[model samples]
Target: MNKSNIYQCADCHTGSGTPQALQAPKVRTHLPSVTNYSCTDCHSKVVVNAGPTAANVTAHYAIRPTVPTSNYCDYCHGPNATSPFPARNKTIPQFAHDDPGWDGNATCRTCHTNSSVSADPLANDTSSFHELTTEYGDAFNGSVKADCVVCHVQKSPQFVAAPNPPHDISGMAAPDCYGCHGVNVPGTEAQKLHNPTPTTTGGCIACHSNNATRYYVNKSLFALHANVNTTDGMNNVTDADCKTCHHGAADGTMGMKLGAANSSNTYFCQDCHTSAGTGPTHPSDPNLIKDGLSHGKTDCRWCHLAGDSQPRPLSSQLRYHPNGPRGTAAGKNCLSCHVSANLPDPPFHAPGESHVSDLNACQECHSNADNHAVTPLTQNTPPLVSGLSVSTQITSGTPSQVQFTVSDPMLQIAAAQYQVTNSSGIVFDWTNMTGTFNSNSVTINANIDTSGLVGNYTVNVKGMKSAPRTDPSKPYYPLNGQWSSISNAQLNVIQPTGYDNGTVYGTLGTDIAGATVSTNTGVSTIANSSGFYSLSLTNGTYQLTASKDPEYYPNSSVFVTVTAFTTITQNIILTPKPTGNISGTVTSK
Candidate 1:
């Protein structure tokens, strides 16, 4: 090698030791304790060219200490190795050399070295070594150490360095439990890890021993933890009892340990917070059942509003809980699930006639928590109307009937009424009707007079507990303040009667009596002795004709328009047949 090509110690090493070495030494991004080794520990090889070769430097420093398994490689390359020739253990698992920056791959120089002059393995690089601890520390925390078997089938590896401290379980909440164990408690793959059998010892063997010190645990143990027999709160457990399972040194008495070199040993408080019975279990707290009605005791959240940990205050749970059907946190009121479609299976009262569908008026039917056992019809509610109908189209100045059926739970319908509204939604007419009472419902027929009104209108009927009113300002108000649902029907009042009159005369100005005058609408009238014909029609174009059998030729088609309440006159001139038609034919030949 040329003299200028020789590498000096100051060219690669810096006094601060922050991985600022010029070449391959840049791979050490951070040296935690520099006092553990000296420069000669890695660069002990002496070359005839006055410097250590790149191959000699990387033979021991290629793989860093960040990898957990790298500790096995450090046993021989560390400063404690024998000076002349380090003893190597072949029993340690060997990593593939194709892994970049891990073995003898050429790509290791991309992140390990910074030199461009040399053609060695650690040469011509743009990147420097990055510390794994600084980039991914939170992911490898103590909590996730137990979750390693979720992805990797191989057990966790041993750590030569000190391990991270255990997580504080006090700050955890409900979601933290379901997040690791999964949403469906006994349904996820994590369930097998929670209560593993000796035959199916997949990941549990890491914490539990399967030999002479075997510990038998199964799903039934979770039930034992929940059946404390006290309804006051979580009892039969103390701070001292928790230490035996969670803290303390691992003894052969229990198959659990505080630490393991190659497997998970972490435990959680949710391992025992599950409910255990076939039917209704004990309430989370005694005060949660002060109401006479039964809120669901089978679900833990019915009393423990927070879903996990200690139960919330009694006042808080009751204020936010709802009655049966869906007794969860989303149900905040009795009517939230007590609708007609989702009513109780046995039903509190008779069906059909005894049911009232109310979204906001549940108190009018049931007594709520005050007296839920009483009969439902103890209180009166608004009436309901059904089968409302009227003629869709009618002539002006005509009379029509509006009919409907009204029913009340308390049978207190005192009066029924109907009203007519114009096209502009204005009520112009209101009338009262007499109702014939049957069993629980009443039938009503209201006679309405359109009189002079000519427009589209809507007719509505309603029942009330008080006398009906005609006051325009309060047309819908019932005197006793109880009102029924307003049911409506459509009405169209057409144009009134108009006259189409005409005089039928012969070509010689002679009057033709008994002539028939008919319109296209199937309305016809005979001419009087004076040859005057008349017919009633509405406002529209119509085809008129005057006909008398075989006498003078009938005037076939004539068009005319009649306005409302007005008279239209048209004269019809009919031609008589020639009595001498036979004499003219002989002269043409």
Candidate 2:
């Protein structure tokens, strides 16, 4: 076998004799340098030529720490690996490529970079981090937008990284919980913390505990604090605070704080100050009651006035008097208007011109308080007339006697005298006078010869008062003073001398028959057989007239002139006048 035909492994290069052999390093013959020669020209026998091996390539293509899970890939692809290989066409795991820059070690820059890993799932971008979207979105929609400081540090210069690390897994680092729940610390170190009381549970336990001190303190402190300075310590607080103790106080119950009372304390000044049952005492002033003075209590409204909290002037406090003569010094008396029952005198007299005792009582003008006046007795009577009325009735022949009655309802008859006058202007002289004069009426009787009188005559009755004589020595007449024409009555006399004939007859005409006539005087009369009127008459002229009944003519005498006793036939014609007849027919056109 040829030595040139020995075979060697490519990796370990263990040699073996075969047809294909590993050649020794050969010496190249020098050839002339040629320009622009292609590499394929001499490498035709070598079909495969790997690219030149890289130098420091691992360091140049190091995986970035920001790529998550790429550290696992660096284990195999790193330069220190026995057979570091490139991931030429392989797919990487989901988490394997995450946090690529992280070298599985801690460093300031490692975490400072954009590739820093966060333990909070909320901070991860690819893993549905909710810190930016969900929490902030909910806060924006809520009534109170979430403020970072409400749950975080209360004050600044907060060393977020020292004793209390920036990322506190214990969740107790927030200072906001100290507001309601007092700080809790060891008794030895109590001064270091604010409000270091055992009443509070420190840190997150104060808020998140099953029975948290913050919850209990917030529930009770508002009401307990309000009771500090009230009349009744529990009396006046807000309804919300009262609801802590009385659960229904907010919805209206007896437990409501600061509620108004059902009744109010109110009274009138007159009720206690006036002269009533148990009233205030005052001194007596005689001048007040005597002058009918308007005392202090006269006008209650003057002091009280009208409206709420109206102020009374200091000068108006004194009482005013209105009795004397309004504005006159003597007229000013307090008791003139106000009764003694209502107003009493003041303790001491005011330094002024006071009322005097001689002032009249109220009875002088206002007889009594109820009906303030004096009434006089009066009686109504008819007016008195000094005249007389005389009535007379004369029957045919003898003189008639007249009765005279006089009245003076006011008793003025004793001073009166009467006279009568006729139409002839002659006064009826009182020949015999007998009459009695009383308080109301008087009556007298007088005889009068009324013979031969055929007409009416007026009797004027007049009255006059007997006046005292202007000169006492002169003779006095009965009618002297102012006289009144009292009244007059008329006297009528009828003639009784005419006589009637003893017979009467009826007259008949051509169309007037069966007519009857009779005499009106008390005498015998007859209708003659010839129907002609005949009568005996004294020497005088007479008028004779005739009338027909239903269907006859009437007749009348022209005139019967008789100078002596003679048979005068005065004839009357009974005639019927023709009544014109009118008849016509109406025709329609």
Off by over 4 Å in 2: 1-404, 407-433, 437-441, 463-485, 497-546, 549-589
List the lowest-lDDT window of 10 residues for candidate 2: 255-264
Candidate with the greatest lDDT versus the true structure: 1
Question: Which pairs of residues clash in candidate 1, taking residues 3 or more apart in a chain or in different chains?
Answer: none
Q: Candidate 2 has what TM-score?
A: 0.21
List clash counts for every candidate, in order: 0, 36
lDDT (Cα, 0-100) at 499 in candidate 2: 30
Q: Candidate 1's residue-wise lDDT over 1-589, tens digit each?
A: 4425555343444433325443444323323233244344434433223355444443234232222222322233233333332333212222221212222332223112312112334332222333323211212334443232321222233211211113323333333333222232343332322222112123332223222222222222233332333342453432222233333223212222211211123232222232332222333664423333323222233332323222322222232112221223333333332232121111111122224445435455554423222233323467789888897578887787788888765433456778888757766555668654322477888668888778888887787642122242432123432468788888888768788888899888888899888888888899998889988888888888888776877786688899878998987878877665444445553
Question: Per-residue CA lDDT of candidate 2, range 1-589, in tens?
Answer: 3324432222111222233444522211111122122222222222333347533222123222232332332232232233223322122211111121233232211111222333322232322211122222222233433222321233222111111113212233324333423433333211212132222334322332333322222222223334422443453443333233333322333211111111122122232234451312211442222222232223233332211112221122231111111111222332432222111122211111112223354344434322112221112232234334444444334454555555433222222333444566655553434444322344555555666554555654443222222233431222222233445576655443333221223333342334443332222223344545545543455554444465444444444544433454544444555557899999999
lDDT scores in order: 0.44, 0.31
